[model samples]
Target: MTFPYDRARLDALVADVDARLATVEETARAASRVRMRSPGLGAADLAAISRFANSPDAPRELKDLARRVDAGELSWRDVASGRAADDEGVQRALRTGVPDLRRAYAAIREGEDPEDVVEAGRPRVVGDDEDGPSRFTEDAW
Candidate 1:
């Protein structure tokens, strides 16, 4: 899938922070990697992010934050860098409009059900229902 930010914009943003071209591309790839981890985001969901990131109607603050992130002025945990995690720019982006954008694009949290995540590492008997007792279970008596 294509990256949400265009090469030109990414280049320009990185230039503002005096970062290299490879850094911007790496950052964009990291953004894509993060987006891919969202449960409901398919190709269409990614397209929506791309459209919003590139569109004029998108919030200016969000756009600027994204640019700063691309420029390496901000830190995103999903993206590897020497910068501190949870920087103000990253926090603001996550708090202000990023979740709304994800919701608007229908990016569900990971797992079929929220509880599924908690149980992810546990082993379950075959044919056992999640909401019902296991076949091997009986009265403790």
Candidate 2:
């Protein structure tokens, strides 16, 4: 019995997979760096941002911000802190009635800088108010 597979085709497929894997690894590294710089965001938040950034319908400023984050030139914190507010694409998105874009703009306007709240010794909570009593406080009795 003779095998029907072509060696060249298999080699090309392997090369393509290797390239894709490299791209994925790089993207993960970049995402990790972004998360480190912006502690307020969770994995789900990052995934939503990634999806929006990759969308062709996304504003150009948003895409540029994502690129800058990936390139280590800027962090998601920077963008959240109104870094891209004045960019043309952002302005256009705001003017054209994109609800999500408006929400993003609002976030930029209202977002607090993570670096400002994070202290050397204090632990920062990512979500919810930990200042309130714990849920188990009454149950422990």
Candidate 3:
């Protein structure tokens, strides 16, 4: 059965999915020092996942689960509580999305060169260092 989409409902779903993705991020980072170089990469991946979750193409099961939450049939936190004792619908949603998110996060974090990502305190050259520069070298007469 289909249910009307609500923004708050979708946001809750997105936040739950994002939290699940966070476990993948933290595990990956802790597993390897190299993966930690791009600090904001996890946030970017989570944003992408949120977009995916809200999109029409997101798994129908996820929508149904969200509908249940919105309808007050289930508490949203139960969805990603990470305990086997949680409701089956919540576990199903977690199982459905975690692997895919893990793969996406891996690709996102591994595919980019860390140096290319913007970071604080990194050095940047403002102008040419050659001595023959025309603009700064010439004095106004």
Candidate number achieving the greatest lDDT relative to the actual structure: 2
Q: Write the per-residue lDDT of candidate 2 for residues 7-54, one digit (tens) a residue.
A: 999999999999999999999989886643333455555566667676
Tens-digit lDDT track for model 1 on 42-126?
Answer: 4554444445545676566557655765676643333222144356654554566554434433424542332343244234453
lDDT at position 46, candidate 1: 41
Ranking by lDDT: 2, 3, 1
- The CA lDDT of each predicted structure is 0.50, 0.58, 0.56
Instruction: Name model 2 segments beyond 4 Å from true.
Output: 1-41, 81-99, 103-141
Q: Itemize residue pairs with steric clashes in candidate 3.
A: none
Clashing pairs in 2: none
